[model samples]
Target: MTGQFQKSSMYMEHNPGIVENGDFRKNLDDDGRPKRTGTWMTASAHIITAVIGSGVLSLAWAIAQLGWVAGPAVLMAFSFITYFTSTLLADCYRSPDPVHGKRNYTYMDVVRANLGGRKVQLCGLAQYGNLIGVTIGYTITASISMVAVKRSNCFHKHGHHVKCRTSNNPFMIIFACIQILLSQIPNFHKLSWLSIIAAVMSFAYSSIGLGLSVAKVIAGPHARTTLTGGTVGIDVSASDKVWKTFQAIGDIAFAYAYSTVLVEIQDTLKSPPAENKAMKRATSIGIATTTVFYVLCGCVGYAAFGNDAPGNFLTGFGFYEPFWLVDLANICIAIHLIGAYQVFCQPIFGFVESQCAKRWPESKFINSEHAVNLPFHGAYCFNSFRLVWRTAYVVMTAILAMLFPFFNDFLGLLGAASFWPLTVYFPIEMYIARTKMPRFSFTWTWMKILSWACLVISLVSAAAAIQGLATDVKKYKPFQTEQ
Candidate 1:
């Protein structure tokens, strides 16, 4: 019994649990492990990355479909919902219990504990599917950016006579693989600095792009045009119902799909007591920054193109009045996207490393040789598996990009599916099941209502987005035609 207790103590020291009572200090050495400064920045950057993926670019089109008023309203609603749900999640982390401990409960664990095993499994599967879609979407976006760059450069030097096929080349595959490897280094502290820099760059690029887009739209000839007889240039006649369904699904999928990163944020922070405050502040800062950026981009994109907006913001550059702005926006967007990819890939690589170490005993190459030691051995193994897993990641990304080169619709659906479980549903469920609220308090009532609302919204939106994607696949069939 004494031996077991001692081992447990050692484990706790290595893998500190939830932040409660305001103790956020880490248990590991600062050499390679997470430090206070890095963890905060990484957490912030992760939120930004998750919030500002291909979705930012595509949302303009989605909003346009619903009309100017309805689209911006929905975006505002989404921002509020995200904020409220993230707050509830912070509350859940404040709960006192083994299950509520930091690094203990994944989005899956929280859902299962509150919603039931079945729901947990369902949500988990949905999240995984969403992640796959998101990964592919990022890859596709990267490819498109690369192609655009090559084509643009060629056009500048030799005029539009030369056709550039660089987007479809093998170099992108290699670049993505390299990115995955770099992200797998397992130094949260170091990555945090990168994330801050990335965040600054993303903010700057997004701001400039938004300003330029807005100016073009307002000053362009098409600013006052309205749809005649409810017809936008694109034909929605063949599959109106399917399109609507897909839209709703996309909303739900994207709304909470980003919640999984919360776990990563929690893990990187100093242990409970300290973790609690850091996480709340981090969540608040990150979510707020993301919301502002999304809203700004969405509004600008919608205003510029109105009903004619392309799914991705960058692609809509064709609508910009002065062609020079298009080139500038593309450069900013490309750099920002690269930063976004790095942030998004970090936690995923961490999770994979942990899982791999558990499955393979002799994979000491990850821990000792790679100089990556996680507080959790499982996490260490998963991180180590990066060398092997990265190849698969690259292959899958390339194949998916080839099959679905454009990710606007797919990203929407994925976001709706994953966002609810991770951000809204799981957090509320976890708090309700594990925490004791003050008797007859307004806070308790508000929380209950908020949780129920999130669940409902998540489900409805996910369904709609999925339906929308299915319709798009049927209508476009790019893969089939290519084959």
Candidate 2:
């Protein structure tokens, strides 16, 4: 305990922005901000990469379930809602006094700063679950993407059993090892280069999916007409329509759900008080970029496959013309997830490393600097604590992925759990409280109502998702050569 205090004091000395009570000292510049540094382009790239997760692949199916009108409506609604909430988060980055606040670096920091109480613990639980789930989700997504491409070209091509020894298990395990290595990145800000690559990969694959779907729609009979292959038609009174639309709400929310990491990404910028101006601009551009792709991919995918669209169009697209395009797109997905797994996991390591430092103050394995000296032919640095935490973290996720390899199921569950709270509820509620808006005012009334509505929606979606998990569990078989 004494040594822990000493280390804590040391950390506080070196990082004056953080205090013993986990609050910022008032000695910071007017609007509690550090260096104002990151560029808008780089920030946009990071947001784009973070926002366009594997969820976008499900947008086509989401559209099919929501029907043409409701589908596009929900997408646009989520887009605008997320953008607004993101700006609120950007404004919240500053401390109590806008003129005399230090930036809140992490999501928990924001929660602790504004709405302090037992809510902190609740926030921690939800945030950690969401982040870890994201890492595991990435592994699950990558393995499926790779397996789809490989099976198309190798396993199925060779006339082997679909559940043979060489199935998705090996690829999943390999990517888990890869994540262990990528998770070495010291902090969230350092992921700029990888985010750029990830953004391009997202664009590349999404564009291909859109283009092919458009081609199929054009080539098919009654291409210009509204034909729904029976399941989804103009009447829209299908048996499970309402439930499926709620499910689609979860998917759209998932695709638009990047708010959890928005503040962390903002901290990477180099401005005093981490200027909201830059963050707002980045948020706008990021949403704009993703919206373009989302609309194209979702529309084409729904039009081409109609109600038959699977939860993930990549797997559902089947072996169509220009087969190599599918392989290339899948390859891009694998690479993008590699970078994304690191982006989300970096913050988890931040949480873990902080706890470890608090726990084992004297151990050399855990350092105060959040940094390490890797003498790689010169001065390439690494964090020893990071090395340990990330390795174990990846291994745990890998094991889980191996045990239950349900890609969309896990995605839906995590999205339902975190999307509403992180993306919609917290941001607006925090904004209302911090700004001291009148509880009875028209603006405050509407915003508060919206926030509560979203919270309720999230709760319902979570219940539905959990109820479906029983089916997934029944189907999963660990270590079985075939799925």
Candidate 3:
């Protein structure tokens, strides 16, 4: 880190107007870009928007698999691990010196600065792959919520006993079309409003779920629950129990998967008190807020439905009466996912566009941005490549979602694939490298142990999720997923 600092300082000496905290500088950022105005509050909103996503909807089923004692315990455990490693990764946003060092714009940049070589390629593959999976998951989740709204009304009119099955394919198409428009928002700098709206929607649906679960618990006829979760012989077979427990771990792991885009989020922050400082504080607040909500939703939902808990409280038809409230909750979920798909996909869009611009520097199609004035709105810079590429990406994910709309399985697989590599291993390795901790030191050893343990967890979770996906695929045909 010190050596890198020397190189950065040398480069800064050669570059005149791009120095941080310069008195004689124009109203531009240290990178010679527009000034960043993101405060800790906006950063916190972004974190919350990313953290509390579709994964939260599956927590009741996850808790049902793990039972009462282990469920809440595992949730809290992931909360601690996520916050701790986030603080570590936050510091790496600036190399050599976290406060004054040159910025690493993306997660890949952080890895290249701290631990270069093949690790950078591996980090990109993991980060981008996980992002693709998340967007697909969000598409499926949003479609489910949309279908749930209609189903809730149907159940209310025709009674819960009627077989009111609805296909998710149409709804998935609807969500993809919505994403195609929102995906053209340019970049993260322009996404604060969407994220803020998404964050509020997340809170709205989460609070509604929690409130409904509490009501169900108080309504008198509570389902059976146990400290050890599902009974082996009655609720599930022995082998089934093991798979579900692992899948539950994966679900919880996915719920805390905001680290992949942490640096990107941090890049939006203004630095006077330092970007790393604000990001760390935002991470702490975001994780703490999500943890409280997770506990309430998971534990209370488990208490309400017990071993028979649905995969999603709102969309899985957990509540029937007060159908209007259920419809509102589902509507909230759909709105939140609309924003979330953009929050996660913007990085992919930016990365691909930047790379294209570098490769074909003279191409007008990819490089040109045409300014068009709207009736009431200001000038909008339109790019042809962005429209085509992002539209294709959205359409692809929606088709995939329509093919296999297994909600819990997809969430678990994405969580398992991303949690260890992007969330645990890379962050720990980069932190250790930046700090230059001795291999045999106590703290270093502990960090390595933690990373490896998470690896094992991720592996088992992946296996279970794969098995679950295979089972679901065998039962249903593609593009014909009915709720």
**Top lDDT: which candidate number?**
3
lDDT of all predictions, in order shown?
0.57, 0.74, 0.86
Per-residue lDDT tens digits of candidate 3, residues 56-148?
A: 877999999998899999999999999999998999999878998988888999999999999899889888988888888889888889988
lDDT of 2 at 410: 64
Score every model by TM-score: 0.75, 0.86, 0.93
Which residue pairs show collisions in model 3? Answer: 67-229
lDDT string for model 1 (430-453, tens) is 666665667457877886677676
Query: What is the C-alpha lDDT profile of model 2 across 1-483, one tens digit per residue?
Result: 012222322234344545533235443333333333467788898899899976677788888777687788888988998999999888877778543477686888888898888766767777778888888778877888887776556544555344323467788889988877777666676689999999999988888788888888888853332333225355356645666767777778778888778888887776542467788999999998898889888878888877767777675444334657888888988998988887788778777776766676566556643322344533334445667778988999888877767745765777787777778777887887797898789998888788887787787777667656766678767656443
For model 3 the TM-score comes to 0.93
Whole-model lDDT for model 2 versus the true structure? 0.74
Per-model clash counts, in order, read: 43, 17, 1
Whichever of 2 and 3 has more TM-score, that candidate is 3
Task: Report how far off residue 31 is in candidate 3 (Å).
Answer: 1.1
